[model samples]
Target: MSSSHDTHAAHDAATSHGAHAEKKSMRLMLHVWRQRDPSAEGKFVTYKLDDVSPDMSFLEMLDVLNERLIAGGDEAIAFDHDCREGICGACSLTINGQPHGFESETTTCQIHMRRFEDGQTIYIEPFRANAFPVVKDLVVDRGAFDRIIAAGGFITARAGSAPDANALPVPQVAADAAMDAAACIGCGACVAACKNASAMLFVSAKVSHLALLPQGQAERNSRVLAMVEQMDKEGFGNCTNESECEAACPKGISVSNIARLNREYLRALASSD
Candidate 1:
C-alpha cells in the first residue's frame, strides 16, 4: 500500500491539475445530426469533445473534433463553411434551434466557443426544408437559392466603367434602402427559421435591393414575377406574415421587405394588363 504522505501528495497534485484543466479548457456535449446521404434517414448522435479552447471559433471546434474522428477511424462530421470571415453565408447551420447560433448580425463561422457554457449540450443540424435537402451529415443543398438568383436577380444593363457622379442620380433614401437590402448574403436562414419554410425574406431582399435602384427599373416587373414563379415551383412554402424569418435572420433583414415583395407582385400583375 502507498504511504499516507505519498497518498496526500498525489491527491493534492490531482486536485490542482483538475482545477487547471477546468480553467483552461471546456468539455462540450454535442448532439449532432448524422445523415449518410439525402435519401438516408438522419438522427442525432451524441459526441463529447474535451479540451476545447474558448477562443476557438465554432468551425475550429468542429475541426478539432473531425481531426480526432479521422484519427479514430470514424466518419468525420461534414459541415459547410467558407470565408470564415463571415462574409460568405456558406455556414448554414441551425444551432440550438436558432439560425447562426443566436448571435445578432453574425454567421455560424463567426460563432465563438466561448458563448457556450462548459459541458453544455449543443444541438447542431442542417437547415431543414423541402427545397434544401440534406446532401450529407450537416450539409444541405442550398442550390435552390442560386437558382432563384439566376432566374432574374440581375440587371442586363451593360456597365463598362463607373458612371459619372451626376449621372443617374438616385434619391438618398432609396440608395440607403437598396444598400440595406443588398446586405443579404443569401444564406437561407430566413427559410430555416420560418415554421412554414418560406423563402419570402430571401426573395424580398433581392427584389427590394434591385427595385429601389434606378438601374433595376428596366426589369423590376418581370424580376419579381419570374423569381416568385420559380420560388413556388421549387416547393417553398408561402409566407403567412409570422415574422419568424425576420427574428432569425443573421443580417437583421426586416419583414417589411416581404410586404414590399407583395406590393411589387401586385404591381407586376397590373402592368401585365
Candidate 2:
C-alpha cells in the first residue's frame, strides 16, 4: 500500500479506538419508572449507562437513554421540556425526593450531570400533586394552574394603542415587589414539594404580583377572592404553615405572599357586603 493510504488507515484506527474508549468510560445507573400510560401500572426499571459525559445536562442524559431505547425497538421514556433554559417551567421532575434536584433557584432543565457522582443511581419522578394528574411517565397535566389563572389573575386591558409604560410612575418598592412575584414560572415545584400539596405559594405569587401594581388595582378585590376560591375548588389542600413550599420553590417566592393573599381575601369579603 502507498504511504499516504497507510497513514490515513492509521488515523482512522486511532480515531475509532478513541471513540470506543470514550464510550467505555461512561458509567451510571438510572432507575426510571416505566408507565405506558396514565391508566397503566408503573414500576421502576433499571438501566446501566456507560460513557455518559458529566457535562451533559440531566435532560440530555435522558435523551441519550431514549435514543438507546428507540434503537433497541423499545418505548422511550416520556418527560416534558420547553426552552430548556429554566424559563419556560415546562421541564418538571422530582430528583431524589427534591424538586429540580441539585440546582438552586433553577428548574429541572437546567440541572447538569456534574451534580451527580459516577456510578450513582438516580431516581426521577414526575411532580406529584392531586390537581396535577399524571399524563405519562414524568409528565403531568398542569392545566389546573391555567384554570386558576383564568379565574381572575390578569388585567382586563384590551389590545389597542398601548399606554406608555412610565405613564403611571409606580413606586420602586412596589414595582420591585411586583417583579419578584412575577418571577414565578408556574412549574408547580411549590405544589409538589408541599406536604399537603397546597397551591398557596403558586396562587399567591400570581395574586400578589398584580395586587401590588397600579394596573392590577381595579380588580384587586375581585381578583384575590376569585383566584383563591378557584384554587380551593381545584381540590388543593390548604396551607398548614409548613414552609416546604418556600424551600422547594425554584423561584424562591416568599411565603409572605400567601399572607398577603389571605389579607386581601379578608378585605374583599369585608367590603363586599
Candidate 3:
C-alpha cells in the first residue's frame, strides 16, 4: 500500500546503500626477500595481505603487513624508512623488478596502493651492488657513497659567516645545473638500475654540484680525480653509457652529468701531466 513516491525513494536509498557496500577491500600477494644476515642466503617469503586500502601509501601498506606479523608472534620484516615524505630516499624497495615500482620521478614512499591492482603479486627486494652489501632483508650498506663524498665532495673554504650572495656572480645556467645536481639524495637507485652496477651517475652528480659553483673552482681538478679514484676503489662497475641510471633515478639526474664527470677527469689528467 506504499505510494509511488515512497517506492521511488526506497529504490534510491537501496541504490545508495549498494554503492557504499561495493567498496571491497583489496588484497595482494607479496613475495618479500628475507635474509637473516649478510652471510645468510636470502629467500622469497610469500605473504597474503587482505586489507589493503587504496588510499594507503606503499610504505603505509608495509606498516600494516608488519603489524599483522608482529601480532601473530612472527618476526617482523625489516626495511628502511625515514621521513616517509619521499625526501629522505631511505625507502629502498625494488617493486616487481623496478627500482620504485615503475613510477616516474617518484620514490617508493610517494607511491600509493591505488596504482596496483587487486590480487597483484608484488616482489620486493633491496638494492643490489657489491659496494652495497645487503645488511638485512631490505637494508643495504650505503657507506661507500659516504666515502666517495668524503673523497672530494666539499669546498675547503674557511669556516665563517655566510658569504655575500653578490660576492659571487654565478651564471643562471650554472646555478640551475648546480641545483639540479644538488637534488640527489644519494639513494643509490642508479647503481641498482645499471647493468654494470656503476656509481658514475651518483659520483657525477656530486662532482657537478660543486664543479658548477665558483667556490668549487679551486680543487676542480683534484676533486674529480679523487672522487673517481674512490669510486673505482669501492668496486663500483664502470659506466657503459646504457642510460639506465638516469631512467631509474627518482630525482631524474641527467646523464649529462656523467659526461661532465668524464670531461673533468680528462682535464685533471691533462693538468697533472
Taking all chains together, each candidate's TM-score versus the true structure is 0.90, 0.88, 0.90
After TM-score superposition, the amount by which residue 61's alpha carbon in candidate 2 deviates from its true location, in angstroms, is 0.4
- For candidate 3, write residues 89-111 as lDDT tens digits: 78788899888779888888877
Writing each residue's lDDT as its tens digit, candidate 2 over 1-273 gives: 112433553454456566543323348888887777878888888899987765567898999999999999999999999878778899899988888885678788776565677788889888888799888888989999999999985687553688788777789999999899999999999999988999999999999999998888889999988988899999898899888888888788999999988898999999863
Candidate 3 residue pairs in clash (backbone atoms < 3 Å): none
TM-score, predicted candidate 2 vs. hidden true structure: 0.88
lDDT assessment of candidate 2: 0.83
lDDT per prediction? Answer: 0.87, 0.83, 0.87
Model 1 TM-score is: 0.90
Superposed by TM-score, candidate 3 places the C-alpha of residue 156 at a distance from the truth, in angstroms, of 1.9
lDDT of 1 at 155: 88
Off by over 4 Å in 1: 1-23
